[model samples]
Target: MSSPRPLNRRHFLRTTSAAAATGYFVGSSSLTRGQESPNERPVFATIGLRNQGWSITSKSTKFADFAAFADVDANVLGENLEKLEKQTGKKADGYSDYRKVLERDDIDAVMIATPDHWHTKISVEAMLAGKDVYCEKPLTLTIDEGKLIERVVKQTGRVFQVGTMQRTESDQRFLKAIALIRDGRIGEIVKVTCGINGATGSPVIPAIDVPEGLDWDKWLGPAAKVPYRALPQMREGYGGGVPLYTNCHYAWRNWYEYSGGQMNDWGAHHVDIATWALGASDSGPNKITPVSYSLPVEYENGYPTVDDQYNSPTKFEIHANMPGDIPLVITSEGDNGILFEGTKGRFFVNRGKLTGKPVEDLESNPLPEGAVEAVYGGPVSENHTANFVAAMASREQPISDVWSHNRMLEICHLANIAIRLGRELNWDPTKREIVGDEQANAFLSRECRKGYEIDM
Candidate 1:
C-alpha cells in the first residue's frame, strides 16, 4: 500500500478557519475567541462521567472545556461536576441523559467513557449531531458495531479519537517493542503470543434495589435487561449499584453482555499494538482457530448460573492469519503481556516491562528513519487528548482513527467468536464477514433493543 500524503499544517489552518466561520461545531462548544474559544479550549461535554471518564476529561487540556457532563447515575455526575468546577473553576451543567447533552449547540465535542454496549450508539448519534468524539477503547462491543461506527464517521466527516492512551505514552514499552520488531530488528516475524487473564469466577452477590438518583434502565442501554446490582466503585468516584459480579462498571469487561472480556479489554491495547506494528491496520485475520479454551463451568442460581453469563472464553489460543500467510497466535496465559517471536529472536512486553533474547538488542533497534512517521502521519502529538484536539482543528485523522481502530477491534471480536463457536472460522476481510458458518456469522451483529438499531 502506498503512503498517504502527509497533511500540511497550512492547509489544516485554512480548513479549520473556514469550518469555524461556517458555524461548524466541532463538538459541544462553538468556536469562539473568548474565555471558551475553540482555538484556546474547545467547549466539550463528557458522557459516562465515571472512572476512565474523569481521566479522559482531565487530559483535555489543549482543546476542550468541561461545558456539560452526562451520566445515567446522577450521583456520579454530581461528583464529577463538582470536581470539574473545583479544578477548572468552570461551572458545567449536569444531565442524566446523553441526548440532552448532545442537543446543546454550545458544546463542540464529547468524550464518551460508557460501557462497550453504549459506545456505538452514543458515538454514531454524537457524530450525526456534528460533534467530534473521543470514545473509550475497544471502540465497539461487536464486530458489526465497529463497521457501523466507521461508516457513520465517514458519512459525518467528524474527528473521532478512540481512547487508546497506550498509543500516546512514549515509554509504553509494548508499542516501542513492536516498533522495534516491525523494523526487522527481530528478523522475519513468525508468531506472537499475547497473554491476558481469563474471566474471574462470578462473585456471590444478591441483586439489590436500584439507587435513588440513578436511571438504572437507561444505564442498561441497548444491553439485555438484568437485575440491578451496586455499581462497582470506580477509582475516580462512586458508581450506581451494578455489582462486582456483573462487573457492571469497570469490570463490565468480564461479562459478554457488556464487553468482550480480556480478549477485547487487553486485546484492544496489546493486540492493537501488534497489528499496528505489522502495518495491518486496514485488515485483520483471514482465519481464527481456537487451539484451546476453558468455558466457565455451569452454575445454579447463586452458586454458578448454568446460563452463559460471561460470554468470553476464560482460556483460549486463537491463531490470526495476517497477510503473507503469517500466522499470529494470540494466546491467553500467565496474566497479561505480549510476546513477539521472529526468525532471529523473540521479545515479551507488558505494562510492567519488556524482556527478550537480549536487552541490548532491543535497545539498539530503531525503525527505518521515516517508517514510524509513515505509519502515524501528521504532527505527532505526544498527548492523546491533545492529538484529538489537534485533529479536530486540522480536520485530519487522529492517531487512533475509526478505520484503524475497527481493524484491530475486528481481530479481538473474531477471536471471541471463534472461542464461542468452539471451532475454526474462515474470514473474508474484503467482505468483512465470516465464510460458510451462518451460525458464527450470526454473532457479528446483535439485535439491538427496539428503537436502538444502528442504521448502517
Candidate 2:
C-alpha cells in the first residue's frame, strides 16, 4: 500500500470548530453511521491479550468487531479468545504471533497493549501494514522510540491513539479539570504536582523454566534474551494470579528491561493530563532534576548491575523545569492524582474524583456552557475506545494523538533517565536530546537485540 499524506491538523481544527459552533461535532456524525451498519464497524485485533490488552478490547467491542487476538504466550492468547467469545458470542481467530494478525486485510485497526519495548516495533509495522493503531501508554520505552513511532505514524497517515484514556474516559472529570484550567478558574499556574504512587522492590527471583504454552524467546522480542525469572508467589489483586516477581508477566513493570516501573506505568496517565492542562503538549521540560530516588538494585554507568531482581527505582521525586518556569514535580508520594496549583485557586483530579475550591465553586458558578466539549475538541465519546472509533470514522487524529502523547511521555522518560543516572539533565525539547551530555543522551534510544531490529 502506498503511504498517503498525513492528516491536515489545521484544517481539521477549523472544520471541527465550525461544526462545534453549530452544535454539531465532527466525529459524532460520522461515527453514528458505523453503528447503523454492521459491515461498517471497524474490525479490530488486539496484539497483547494480557492485563490491559484485554481491558481495552473488552471496552472497545462496543464500537468495533473483534476479528482476531494475538499474544506471544499461547496460553494467554487462548484464554482471552475464550473470554471474548463468552462475552460477545463471536468466535474470533487467535494467533501466537502478532504479525499474522497484522497481515490480515480484514483487520482495520489494531489495539496494541504489548510491553514497552515492543510498542514501537509492532506499532510501526502495523501502520505500515495499513492498519490504524490504538496503542497503550507510555507509548514507547525510550525517547527515540517515540520519535520512530511519530515518524511512522505521519508517514503512513494512520489514525493513531495513545492509550491515555484520561483524555476521553475518567467520567469526564479530567476533561472538566482541563476546562477549569483553561477557563482561568485556577488563575495563573504556579506549580503542578503529579502524585503517581510509588513501586515496591522485589525479592531475588531465581531463573525458572519457562511456563507451559509460553514462548520465552518471542516474549523477549527486542529485549535482550534472558532467563525467565519467577518467584511462584502470587499477586493478590488486579493483574494477579500470575507469579508476582516474574519478568515476563504483570511484574515486568518492575524491570527496566521491559517497563519503566510506576514512572511510566502510572506516570503515563497522570503526566499526560498534567502536561495537557499546563498547555505544554507541544513543548516539554527543559531540565529534569532527580531530587531524590532509590533503586532496588545497584547500577553502573546507568545500567542495572544485577539481573535477578527488579532494577527500576522504587521511589523517586523528580523535578522537571517546564515552560513558564513551572515546577512539574513527579513524585512517588501523595495521592495517585494530579494537583494543579495556580495563583487564584488549586484543584486535584484523578479517575475517582475532581476536587478542591475550583471544583467546589463550580456548583454556584458553573462553567460556560459546552466548556467540557470545548476542552475535548468536540462532544466527548462514551469512552476512550469510542473516541478512537470516532477518529477512525472521521479520519482525524483522536483526542490522545501520538504527537502530544510523545511530548508528555518525553518528560516521563527523562525523569527515569535522571533518577537512573542520579543527576540533573539538561534537555533541549526542540532538539529532543540531552544537551552536551553524550553519555546521558545515549540512553535516549536502545539498540535492539540481534534479529529483532525494527524494519524501517
Q: List model 1 lDDT by residue over 255-333, tens digit each.
A: 7778888888878988888887777887878888888977675522212343335545677778888987777777777
146-230, model 2: which lDDT tens digit per residue? 9988888778778888899888777899999999999999899999999999888888899989999999998899999899999
TM-score of 1: 0.86
| Candidate 1 all-Cα RMSD | 5.1
Point out the worst 10-residue segment of candidate 2 by lDDT.
23-32
Best by lDDT: 2
Clashing pairs in 2: none
Candidate 2, residue 407: CA error in Å?
A: 0.5
Off by over 4 Å in 1: 1-39, 170-175, 230-243, 297-311, 357-359, 362-375, 454-456
